[model samples]
Target: MTTQQSAIYYPAGEIEEFLPQIGRVVEIKDHELAVFRTSDGTIFAAENRNPHPKGGPLAEGIVSGYYLYDPLYDWKIDLNTGLVQAPDQGQVQMYPVKVENGQVWVAL
Candidate 1:
């Protein structure tokens, strides 16, 4: 599947609040996304809800490279593609994020 869908990108917030290696939840309309800003200044957005049975908090998950580890079920979800990698797995819906002029835009 395509990484980014053709949709309007809504302004979430500035670059400062989204620190490196930290993930935060951003809500727009009926959508909720787990937005992460990597140490290298790259940003990735994905569905806040987990695919596991417990439905862990993905936003608070640990970030290692381009993968986000689920907090509850412990799944390594790809920050860019949202593919669950190895061990126990399931796919989490991924979204598009664009940073322009130090502002974060989310395409839901």
Candidate 2:
């Protein structure tokens, strides 16, 4: 069996470089998260912690309206709903990601 391992690192204050690709996954502090771009060119951030065995990473989690999918349980939660998905949810943390002067900046 192949196990997926995560490499935790923070991209806080480096939003420019990472903003170009919408729906891309980035790691912060060893946790996986998703970076998405709306049709209006607005960027949104969400946690990519999947609880299912065949689920994908946070970046692969579904985004609909203001909620992001859990990929495992197929649960939906608000993107701005903070790091933890819910009480006892054990979701990944969501960080504030932004781009300025062509640079991606994540609030640590």
Output the number of the lDDT-best candidate.
1
Q: How close is candidate 1 to the true structure, as a TM-score?
A: 0.89
lDDT of 2 at 19: 35
**Segments in model 1 whose C-alpha atoms lie over 4 Å from true places:** 1-6
lDDT of each: 0.82, 0.54
Q: What does candidate 1's lDDT look like per residue over 2-101, in tens digits?
A: 1245677888889999988889998887888888988888898888888887786688998888888766776888887788888877888887778888
**What is the lDDT for 8 in model 2?**
26
lDDT of 1 at 10: 86
Number of backbone collisions per candidate: 0, 12
Which lDDT value does model 1 have at 97? 78
Model 1 poorest ten-residue lDDT run:
1-10
lDDT of 1: 0.82
